[model samples]
Target chain A: MELPGIAFYIVAFLTMGGIYAILCLALNMQWGFGGLFNAGIAGFYAVGAYTAAILTSAGSSAHLGGFDLPIVVGLICAGIASGIVGWAIARICVRLKADYLAMASIGIAEIIRLAIVNEEWLTNGSLGISRIPRPLEAFYSGRAAEVVFVVFVWLIVAVTFLVARRLQQSPWGRVMRAIRDNEETAASIGKDVQRFRTETFVVGSVFMGVAGALSAHYFKFFSPDATEPLLITFLAWVMLIAGGSGNNLGAIAGALAIWAIWSLTEVVTQQLPPDWATRSSYIRMLLIGLLLQFVLQRFRSGLFPEKSPKLRISREK
Target chain B: MIDFINFYLIPGITLGSIYALGAVGVSMIFGILRFAHFAHGDLMTVGAYAALTAVWVLGIPALAAIPFAIIVTCLAALLADRLFYRPLRDLPTIYTVIASFGVALILRSIVQTVWGTDSQVYMTGFQKPTIFFDTFRIATRHIQIILATAALTVALHYFLSRTRLGKSMRAVADDPDLAAVAGLDTERIIRWTWIIGAALAAIAGVFVGLDTDVHTNLGWNLLLPMFAAALLGGIGKPLGAIAGGLIIGIAEEACTYPFFGDTLIAPSYKSAVAFVIMVLILIYRPQGLFRGRLM
Candidate 1:
């Protein structure tokens, strides 16, 4: 690839990596901390994107696009909408076993996808929401636009990372881990296991929603068809697992590394003949699938395994 | 009224049988192996293509192609079980489920890349609809599906009830440790579960393909409905799956009636019907209608 092409790819990679970073962080909180096996990451992410799209776009009759809200408001609404749905999912599904949770979440994701496709009045059907009110819209284009967006995504990731790190060190975070490791023990200690799980799920989903909103605004397009639930969910899971699930820094690294590899595959696979070119993406999917199994079997704890927080003898000042 | 019966009822029975067959595979896998087989749908797609190959490519009769597809798909599923599922069997349920999802991805991609993403048929060119009493109308293909599914179900029922291996399989599912202590080969039981499950799944896939056109994404598309049927029937209960499948198949199409109203929801939203039904079931009876194993 030429320098400009390389630069463009890097920018694109970071922007998506940043979005996935947020997604991974959310998933890390749920799976790593709370031990909630949420297979519906795509559902929550889609909710966030669509919520942002509906809120910020000016009303038109192409489907049902008349929110015309401010960007900040749109993003927050995305988070709130996602959180609300997540809370419901948690309340209903959290008590189930980890594997069962996976099934139920898949169902949720499927329902969301169907809704996005069928409910034309709410989601604008398949045409999708475009001309999105991106940040610094008039002030930049092309490379400059890419730089600004990457910076914007980086800021979000940074803030989110800090929040997640802080949470990891907090007493509540400890409780979440406790519940995950031993639900019976956590409950016996007078903790409301279900409530904490629900709260953690909501928090993670809120972050996911905000990330989705940013993704929408950056791309300036949103649609149900664009979601691709299973792949998106699997991508986040693979990133978190590859990063070392409980480690915050590892999540960031995993997000970037996995996204880069995925991008490289897309680039390299483009040189195939037309017939092969049409199907190369599926080959990438096949690789990811095999890679997931290999990692799970061999590098179960991931590259940066979760640090078992030491038993601290606290001396309150 | 006759339009409704012919259009909805006959189609419903045929669709239900397919769902039941797939759900049997799902519930059995859940019972013995103890994880939701997410790749079961893709396996069904594999069966469809195998049948397509048997008929369209290999010049086999359409009817015989069903069993050939079942055998071929079973072999592939068996290989997948050994490579992916068997190793993770002793791990946490979550690990196995994750592996299964990965398997789903791999299987789906295999179908897509190998088969190409085009609609195909085992035998094309429409035949005249067969009418019963000049009111109950079903095409030749539909009758074939109904007979095939009924035959499979009866065979499955006999296998589960009258066979020593089936009895042992049930014993293992109930308590693997005790069954092991009682001298049953746990490995063999697991193998049998996959065999039966895969066979049933292939049958379902081929039947569904017969009803419509075969697509690489067919299995992925059916995942939700199959899972819903399996769950509704109760996780480990074969009978429950059959009942659940029938109800789901009927309800999915029937929802376009006064319940949703045609204006309320398009026919394209048929997939959502199963999801909604599953959610409602989970909300009320997470153990499922048959009161099967919750886990």
Candidate 2:
């Protein structure tokens, strides 16, 4: 490939990796700090993507769309929509044990998926929405457009990182960690553990929504297939666990590292014989699953373990 | 009324039998191991494909392939435990859950790679259902599935209430700490739990294949309803799971029936019935109908 082509590939990689980073950060808030097991990241993601798709896309008779709103409004609406779903789910299932919560969340995600596929009047059924507009697409074209999107994605990642870091250091974050580490202690201290968990779940879901919208805009299309749990929810979980659950920096690193593995495997698998092409995807899935097992078995703390800040004390002693 | 029995009720009972079989395993594992075994659906897939393999290679009847399926799936489940779950046994349940998710992926992918993705049936041609008193018609496989499930339930009942191992298994599921303190072998109980769960799951898988064509997503698609049945029955109660499965299965099929004039729900949304039921149960009766464990 030529220099421009290589550059474009890198741009695409960063764009996707950056979006996954946002998802990882959101998940960090929920599972990493809050000890809430939400296995329905894909549902909130779909809500955001579809919300943005409906709000921003040009009017169409095929499904619900035509607001032609600005991308920023669409993104904001996506976050709100996703956050609402997260809050609803959290309200119902947050108090359950981690395993039960996970099962309930998965059920919700499946229901969301069913609605997406069956509600033709709203989401165009399985056909999905098309022609989703990218940010600043009118001002740039071709290679330049790709670079602009990559930069845009990275900017959001930076903002997400800083926000997540701030939340981790905040008093509220401390309360969340306390609740996660020991719910009884936190509740005894009048911390209201359930409320904090619900709050964290909503906060994390909002980021996931934004990430989903970003992907929609980047692809310029939205489909039910894109909202698959394996790609969105499961991948995000792997990234968070692989990177380091509680550490924001590890989230980004894990996203990039895992995303690299996910994408590059396609390139290598494509080199196989023609008959082997169809089976290669399964091979990739197998490899990824094995990698998760290895990580879970060997590196429970992940790549970057959470480092608690040292308390500053007076010199009276 | 005849139409209801023929088109809806009989099929519902058959489907419910399959769900009950699968849910028994899920409930036992959930109660005993204290983690949702996400790979369970895939284990069903493995059993179905294993049975399919037996049919193709041995040129035997699908029903006859049940033993082969049981053996293969039991081995798969035991191996999965030894390799992936045992190491993480001491960690938080969340880690095991995640590992099981990974295991689900691995199992499904392996099936896809080996069997190919296309849906296949044990026997290509359809069989005529035998009619009873020239009023009701029921398929042979449906009768087999329902009867097989009933027999298994009886056997399971005796095992749980009669056998020493079964009693110990129940004891452990009821209270692991107390069971340990009482000198019951925890590891032995865990192994029996896997065996019983996997054995039922394999039978359920073969039943699903018997009912419809076998495909890669065959088991994955039915996972929600199985979990719903398990939750509805109560986490630790096998008998309750059977009742829950029947209720859910009947409800799912019956909801699509047109009562007043038009269909109550769109056929596409039938799957959501299980999820709705599960959420409601969780809100109203988390301990399940059998008054099982709260945790």
What are the per-candidate TM-scores when only chain A is compared? 0.95, 0.96
Position A243, candidate 2: lDDT: 97
TM-score of chain A of 2: 0.96
Docking category for candidate 1? medium
- lDDT string for model 2 (A138-256, tens) is 99998899898998988989998998998888888888888888889999989887899999999999999999889889888888886557657778988999999999999999999
**For each of the candidates, what fraction of the native contacts does it recover?**
0.87, 0.79
Model 2 chain B poorest 10 in a row by lDDT? B215-224
Clashing pairs in 2: A59-A66
Q: Residue A233's C-alpha lDDT in candidate 1? A: 93
- Superposed on all Cα atoms, model 2 deviates from the true structure by an RMSD in Å of 1.4
Give the whole-model CA lDDT for all candidates, comma-separated.
0.85, 0.90
In candidate 2, stretches whose alpha carbon ends up further than 4 angstroms from where it belongs are: A311-317
Model 1 / residue B211 / CA error / Å: 0.3
DockQ of each: 0.76, 0.84
Worst 10 residues of 1 chain B by lDDT: B256-265
